[model samples]
Target chain A: MNPTPDGFSTRHRGGKKSAARKVRRSSAVNRPSTVKRGKVVSVADGNAAIISKSFQLRSMQRAWNRFHAGSLSHWTTTIIIALSLTIFGAFTLLLSNANTALDNWTGDNLVTVFLEERTSIEQIESIQTEISKKSGVDQISVVSPAQAMARMKNMLGSEAGLLDSLDDNPLPFSIEFRLTDKKYKKTANLVYEIGTWQGVEAVSYDQIWAEKLAAVIHTFRFVGIALTVLLLTAVALIISNTIKLTIIARRDEVEVMRFMGATDSFIKTPFVYEGVLQGLFGAIGALLLTSLLYWGGQGAAAELGAAFGIFFELHYLQVGQLLIIMALGIFLGLIGALISLSRFLEI
Target chain B: MSSESLPLLIAKGLKKAFSVGKNSSLEVLKGIDLSIDKGEMVALLGDSGSGKSTLIQILGTLDRPSSGVVTLNGINLFALNPKEQAVVRNQKIGFIYQFHRLLPEFSARENVMMPLLIGRCSPKLAKERAGEILEKVGLAGRLDHRPGQLSGGEQQRVAIARSIVTEPVLLLADEPTGNLDSRTAGSVFELLQKLNQDLGLSCLMVTHNNELAQNLDRQLHMIDGCLAEEERGK
Candidate 1:
């Protein structure tokens, strides 16, 4: 559409390699007595024209034109591919940041006490007052069932919509007490001491959470690595398969180019550009979607914190990290093109 | 070092064999020596299985000979690497197959500009050159027509234009007009002769048309991988 590109023109002959430009003058055709042709361009020069750098730029322009000239079906497949990659990238982003969120949750080193199911506000107040008297004690806060539900909703973000079907608040009122690090031994003794209180039905401590969080983080690191490999493989295959179809469609053109002495670079450059562009654009799309989701999450977290005193944040990925994601997109595209092209073109 | 006195292409002791099985081989081209001088158009007459294509493939550097050396413009063609040979093919040699092999996706001008683009000419320069050659082939009015839209004669003419657009030193054509009707073939062949004369283009043609062979400067027959001069001469 943009002036038949070099892709269609990468197979012609050289009349005078330009090296032969000044080397000839004696041919009978040069004398113009017998030759009847009009405006003849003699290539009597021994060498063909040298390949120019501008042709490469023109070649890329051609490739870009072809890349965008696909039908609706082609674009749909590409966008669907971008969406799948976005889902995977978003999941990975969340997984990578999980440790940070866990650290924030465990940072205070607090203990929670679940009161009896029907405990009244007076009974919870008495227990909270009694716990405040213990050594190594930080301030204790009483959490009602409605406040607890609100905290859970904040943590769940968009998934909080699932809570509307519930019959009623399934949680009970609880007391959360923060312990100071300087009296770490006293903190454990206080937690045991509180377990024996009259109104307390069950007690929870951050020590267990601290231990569990560390273990889960370590295990998840391995899982995240495995998922990364699988995600990359999927990206490569999707791009490879799509590009392969294009290559198959143009096999004859490719063969003609090869026979006409077109180099591997000459024939393969456009397809490779297609793959890279697809990957890069796809990656950009995924990153944008991921960012939008994280923004929504950050807002939800802020709302929950203001309403129930819980802390969380979905901090945006740093610039260096974002660049790495972009690099990953570019790399996926190149590898995909290489895989498909190598199989189909045998180059 | 002077190309003026050196032949356009020379092949000496060229032998090619294929492995038909585990230990044995089938010799397609027997040891042979051949040469084409500057601006000479020589026709090689042979039947289908007479090894003419195999010989030309080697001479064109598309395929290497089992044991032989080919020198084009006094530089040993086979001695160069595949990449170098490809450059030579694009710059110095042009080929026309029986089928015209033009890329159907492109217009006549675009198809004609392929070799120049492959050789890395600027797009503007390539376009001008392609227009000139297409005009020479009498396709000035059909530069934008795709191959499918053109008649067989016009398509073959486009193919010839592409082959000669680079002004190659040697043109190796295999049954160039084989796919066309007699009338179309005659006109295309005549166009080829006119090009050979007007541009001082050297040519090596393999054809089964004996009647057409009498018009070239010289004729030779390839019989079972051997070459013998035919009494037919212009």
Candidate 2:
């Protein structure tokens, strides 16, 4: 008999034939009384159970371990994510500034009606009363010819001296009013109707420029959305591929874990966390990059505004918008991990 | 009917076949019937192509038999779903491969702590148990050493410690000492024998060493997808 490490002789058992017969006989009547029905025993009791806090904590630890082990690849993927999100953020900034500028320019929704040079002051008053009665018209102002000429001189700045050559005020008296309804079509109809009225020489409104600007903003929004979708998809694919490489590198580890009775979630949760971390860090980096762009572009934006004779200010993303970008980054990372895990990690 | 009388594992008519190409099939295990009682150590001796590893895998729930019923602790292993089978594998079975298969990135203690962690054991408890088991396997001083930093014998000892750390009812080792030299292989075999006796851990080890096989309770010799002989150990 073989001596065991404890210096005792190993127990001598029956022959193979007797043991086989016993096993066969036992198999015939084998029914375990301890078997529980419809209830899974906890892992602590030497049975399979769902993931516990300890398991989740270990998974998180492992994710960090993996991130550290493969920092180069992880950082590369993170940089790509950061760059993609930065582009998205820049587009958002541009759209926001354009929208703010449009709002400032169209805030009053003012329309101007120029009267004939021969029109009497009483006629101008009657016309103002008529326009005030029109639907959606508010805040009527009557502009005398001298008042119009004075406004022109103010606008002309240093060139106001050229207007002194005129013997009389050549500007026509005009009526200006704010439209409560800012729809282009409605304002156009109102302007056309007023232009045909007696003593009215021409009718004009800034609604046309507002409408054009709105159309441009709409197109920019569409293109921005399309580009963002494409770029985000690319980011997801990059993350997925990076995770796939990690899976491949750790294939043996996965198999060993599987054989050790690791649940699918137990095996998958760490990878998911890895993806989430990558996305989170990438998003933070993108925010920094976006902030730098905003700060650096502030002076240039001011110069452009001066050139256009208007004030343009670049605003940083609001809290809600920043939170959304962060959330999107996290979501994309999660999706990327799921995609890779689903295709590559069978367990 | 009694727990002591029932074998720890029982397989009846286990068969495994693989498709070769189109019309031909390769049969690896043809109706293999086997059993290992609690605290019994059985040595499976076979040639390279005799399906010993395949049988071990099927018994361990790592691979499914084409047609068979594997009962462990009186539960039909194959009858359970994949998830349930995984739990059974985790809580009831421990596996040792020839190459040790210790994760290169982890320390010996950490590697041994893995199965316990996978079973949802707390890290502190796992660490303590890992330390205790590593001390048992004569690797207390090498607890924090990685597999690469250790010798082959030390690595195998770590693997042994990892396998028994969970206190699994059944240990399935596939040529666990196949890659070691004779001296190291003998020591490793002795460790397995000792663990089997001391812990009453049922073991089904596949190996080519007839001398080591003779030390077990029984020796099962497989030839060409069949058990050709069964001999009682010395």
Candidate 3:
């Protein structure tokens, strides 16, 4: 006999005649019994194959059915998750805009040393050279009294006639230099050292307000992160409780499936899918809410910036940040489902 | 070795105990030794709490014995891991509960298709087999009826169809007709008998109906966690 691909052994030609003769003699009584055993064994082997795609589809169907059956509760949990994420997203938007405004304010890092009224050009040049030689100085420029007066007139915009009525230029000659290191302490120390110079009348920089704003931003960031953590934890807990309720409602069905020999994965997969679906929908809702908030707040924020004479524009979350939020929602849902299943689902 | 000589299922010295208190335990099955041959329909009769259900559970691999061995087709059932045992239950054993236990949300056809689906059979084949078996149990016209819509007898017929749809080697029925009227119970028992004769499906049924028990191949009576008497039925 030769082994065939379908796992049956084929008899050679010599036995074929006798096999056919025997089959013809008692075909009704004998043929089907042997064929029936073979078919059953084949079916059993088929059963032992990997889990079918149909099973997964059925689980998804069941999950969707349960989700529909508890629409009110599921939607309520989803809204809670959306609201939590919206709050977090709002804080993120605020911090992002604040940080951008602060960056623009401190970007120049310029220090101005005002000269005495009678300082000579030679003295101004000497001060400029000395400032340029400092450790953190990048670019130095000498601003004559006339140039300073011109800058003031330009700033006054449509009021330059009032500047001309001063009868004489009272602006002081100054030397400005850009600092490579913008640290408040470094800039302050440099200003103090320059104030003691021979011909320098005063020294000033915008480091104080920048440093204060930076501190405020840091504090706000910390608080926002802490708040987001708390809110997400609460959301996860709510999801866990919601899933627990559904499990309780279906407790009898679960027990029946277990007795019918459903695998643990088979029983639990639908619940896991339910959690994931909740998270996915919740995240989508949060994104939509956050977008609405951004559009609603954009014009108001711009007007507020104009009041303070600062150019402020609200930027929506970056692609990476949006992805992070979505991922967090999904992860929280998974964790919540796992928590409930581990605690309540004994099978 | 012929199929008739080798029993399809055998339980030797099976014992089960439950811890009742800190220092006390309740024994359910002191020790049970039983076997059911191929194509044999055996009836188990006992009063309430006589360990009949526990024995059925153990033999079906739904529960484990505290000690002793249960071999189905010469394979030690308890020796397999839970996952493998579940596979055995899915493919080799079928259960018919007293309450018909059909998922109320699904129709009769879907309920009957469940075991085959659990065994990873294709949905189309499961549906065809389920429909065929439902018709075989005289429920052809009620395939779409949910359990809530079906009468008690019709529900039991659906349950029978589900149990036999898998074509399992052994059917462990715990009071399959317990909740039906005598007329309904007799009809259900006749269906079981017909399936046994036509399909050669082996069964171990727990029942309180002695009249029905007397028609099976054998009847074992349980009394206080022990098999007290055995009678060959005609």
Best by DockQ: 3
Give one digit per residue, the lDDT tens place, for model 1 in A1-347.
12355443333333554422311221222211111121223343432232334346655776677677855534654575467566666666665566566666667787899998888888999999888887666878999899999999998999999999999889999999887663445666777878898878888886665566567877876776677678778878888887888888878777678767776677788888888877778778878887887877777767755653456566776677677767877788889889998887774
Off by over 4 Å in 3: A1-58, A115-123, A143-173, A198-202, B1-4, B19-26, B228-231
Higher-ranked by TM-score: 2 or 3? 2
Name the docking class for model 2.
acceptable
Ranked candidates, highest TM-score first: 2, 3, 1
How high is each candidate's TM-score? 0.73, 0.86, 0.84
lDDT of 3 by residue, A1-347 (tens): 32211111121222223322332232222111112321221223343232344446666676767777766788998899888888888888888888888888788788889999999888888888888888989878888889998898887899888876687889899988889887888899889999999999998777677788899999999999999999999999999998999899889888678767677878898898788778877888888999999999999999978976678888898898788779878887888888889988887
- List native contact recovery per candidate, as a fraction of 1: 0.22, 0.31, 0.19
Clashing pairs in 2: none
For model 2, residues B114-214, the per-residue Cα lDDT tens digits are 77655544445556678888998999899999999999999999999988876788999999999999999999999998898888999999999888888
Interface RMSD of 1: 11.4
Residues B40-66 of candidate 3 have per-residue lDDT tens digits of 999999999999999998998878899
DockQ of each: 0.33, 0.25, 0.35
